[model samples]
Target: MDMSWPHQSQPLPRRRALAAATGLAAGILLPTRTSRAAASGPTQASALNAAASYANPVIWQDFADIDVIRVGTTYYASASTMHYSPGAPVLRSYDLVNWEIAGHSVPVLDFGAKYDLNGARGYVRGIWASSLAYRPSNRTFYWLGQIDFARTYVYTATAVEGPWNRLTTISTPYYDAGLLVDSDDTLYVAYGNTTISVAQLSPDGRSQVRTQQVFTAPPSVGTLEGSRFYKINGQYYIFLTRPANGQYILKSSGGPFGPYTMRQVLLDLRGPIPGGGVPHQGGLVQTPSGAWYYMAFVDAYPGGRMPVLAPVSWSPDGWPVVQLVNGTWGSSYPSPAVPVPPRPVTPMTGVDTFDGTTLKPRWEWNHNPDNTKWSVGNGLTLRTATVTNDLYWARDTLTHRVQGPTSTATVQLDHSAMRDGDRAGLALLRDSSAWIGLERDGGVTRVVMVDGLTMDGNWNTTGTGTEVASAPVSGGRVWLRATADIRPGAARPGTFSYSTDGTTFTRLGPVFSMGNDWRFFMGYRFALFNHATQALGGAVRITRFELSVP
Candidate 1:
């Protein structure tokens, strides 16, 4: 019962050790070499087109609190947002493996009403961990959300992608609420912490009909805020994460909300993971098949959280178990026979060199993007306007790299023709709280760290600044590398280095947090940006981009 415990440290990573265990029972870790296939000419375009063939988007960018629901053949996911856009990031996937940003739950929530006021303003008025619930009887969609941690409300939509009705405020102290519709067409809502509260929803799906009741887990188990409830084989399963003794599940045969018995932990902190345990956000469904699958995030510190998909198998006794043994979750499962074909085993993690005419879908901004700041041309050159400040750049920047417990990204840039306050570099940013970047100043490059946990201001210099190590920008190549060391419970380590040649690397600093801006649209992620006081007068040539989880 020690809730105030701290994170314990671990050893550093070795590439040879990882390669030796690639095909071991831990499931296949896609080889870092496969990344070459991603960068081949026109291959990115083909990949985007091929991604169109995928029906589910299991690997979405920055979509947190990942609650998924399936209707017919379509799967929908919703998450929290402080992004520039009006509402939280919502995506639609056909197969659960491929997803597209279909639209938002509230296309233009109250957050977008005042565009001029920025910097986590969208996060302040309320709205977090919004859940998507399907009303089968009416064939409509319902969205329930916690606003500003003080209010809860529900909105009805004809389609999951909607022109939603006005919000119907539901007074409740619960912060992250999960809504489920049962077999008899009964709608239920579950909410709250160490103990949970559940209540029945009115048939109309717009109101709460039953009184809220507090449910406690049997003393044998641990429980926390995120609770996902589902019914299978005539029994109700309440999936809760304690993060104390790893995450676990509780069960009962009662109604949607239950006097459930607590079950044992499904996945404990007993794997190859370097940091804390797998603290999941919400559960997901395997599309087209209606079979259940769990989509939870594993903390890859300093870099932020990475999504892990596992098959939830049922025991004869009706308890759910995660099949990921040791330290790996396979991309495919034999049981439950999902209908989709397996995607080629490719590196799910890597860096992107923007040479193509269009921006990759994987890139996202905090709020509405100022498209004028960026354009696809002789390499990706981002012009910094007067309105875009460091805080705004932190939010508006288009950044993404592969997400794994360990990986590295190196990008070459041309920043010699830059003006004052112009910064173009490699960044691993997650929230206003956790982020680190290598920025160029007056032709000099320095490593900067913004530790969100400390709520510190300005990107602290890690080491003395160094002059640009590469040749003067007349079409020369420069590289930045990010390396992550994940250990359970302790702060995840992220170290960045740079190179004139793409091969050799010099460490920038010690390993740091891989925090994603999702916690506030700034979850830990590897991204690229160019923000200048005037037009970035020089063409930035990124001749090569590479990422490997060695």
Candidate 2:
């Protein structure tokens, strides 16, 4: 039963009304650091320094496949949120080093039954690479995204924090798509895998007028995707990322349709740096002062692919060159020169009380959530449902991006309502996942740590599961935690633990290794799920959730 509705004509306005109605009027403004960092522990303040220069991996969390655009003095970024409802997160920043979630382009991804968590499922597929473009011609913002196995869509919003208008779908599948509106008001889309492509959109912006292969990567360049297109100073620039190399820029002095020359503009092929990985897939942004910077991500595993900022300047040959220090990516640089008022620095991961009427913008559902199955009123109550035997197929799992190299997430669960055959706990979710939770079996409650592996990319139960540890428990309340140590050159295993008293924890399972599979496309995330293996099961209440870096 898909019960999702089309976004109302005026979503931002309606959202304001809903916020006021729900007593969230005070939270409508840009998030303040004092309020957001109150419960985030000591690491919150230490993450950023009060100096003119900032460190590399500007955003130390998994903000993968980043696409950025500058609007006057403000910088707006849109990133891929595959299968995470309230998809295509839009982040805003005054200084490039700091960012906060402003809003999402879509309230829900209800394109098909799978996206709605119905009989079918969309795991590694939903909204892939998205391109965010602002056209000064009509004062409109366009967001184009590729929905796997479905047609591409272009969403329009007058304001970035939008009541976006859902436009008609483009019948072509544009993988790693990028949207650009030329000064002449001609709409063009660039995308491809091994072969880079460019297409002209119809005047109405609803269909493609013509498509062509602009450039193809040679066999030497392995795994090329994530195309970000731009037309700057009368030159058409297309950026592509290859795991074998770093990021390359293709420049065409001709037009949107091009006879382009390619150059390796940004490369960190020397492998992982102290706080960053190889620089890859991202967009170029310019400040009001006319300074240019490249925002990209590195494959950081358990923490996923995190964003990094690098300074950019053009060479004598008219090619953009990334400013690397001493033949390597710099660890820190002077912050972007932008004049703005003092704003709070917010951490990517924080503490949740589950007392508000709405979940924080940082939290997202694994899939389009069943609104009727969860609530934040009396703590976060997650009602169990028998969707499938495989946890990846389970719906309504709440998740947050896992923070870098080292971080720990803890959740206090009240399982008084859990029925027999129900499993409820905290998990590190990806193609391969593991959880430490309370399972109800034959009227006996036990604390169990289970590891599940998906053999192929499919969402079938053919995958194997191993019970690492189990112990009988008598209480209706339990505290569970998982710690990840994924620092480059360090042992990469996620350890799970449980506690009867919130003060002290007992190690539960064998250390589980974190994995990276291209099929998933994103890094591992911390997730909360409650599901039944057999029949309709019980509910679990998450009283408190906290994430911290050790």
Q: For candidate 1, what is the lDDT?
A: 0.52
- Candidate 2, backbone clash total: 0
Against the true structure, what is each candidate's TM-score? 0.63, 0.85
Residue by residue across 1-550, what tens digits does model 2's lDDT show?
A: 3334323221122112112122211211111212111223232222222234556667767677899987755678998888888899888775787777777887789788988778787776787778998887788888998787468888889886777878768888888988888868898999989799999998778899999999988776666788999877678989898863488888999988899888887555533346336878899876554556888877766567778787777765566777665456655655555554245434566788888798877888988888888999668999985445677767889988877667899999999899888878998888778889987878899999998655465755456467779987777899999998766544678989988889899999898888765567777888999988877758999999998876
lDDT for each candidate structure: 0.52, 0.75
Summarize candidate 1's per-residue lDDT along 1-550 as a digit string, tens digits. 3333222111122101223222324222211212111223122221222111111113523455667877654567776654434465456654455455555565444534333234433422345666777877877787777665665667778775466775576666455677777878887777777778786767775566775555765566545767666665566766676653355566767655566777664555433234433536767454332235677665544444444555555454655555554445543333222233223212334555666786544455544555566676556766553334354333345555344545666677665455555555666654432333434556655445433333222322232222223323223346666665433345556666766665786664445554432233234556565555444543334544565655
CA lDDT of 203 in candidate 2? Answer: 75
RMSD of 1: 11.5
Q: Per-prediction RMSD in angstroms?
A: 11.5, 11.0
TM-score of 2: 0.85
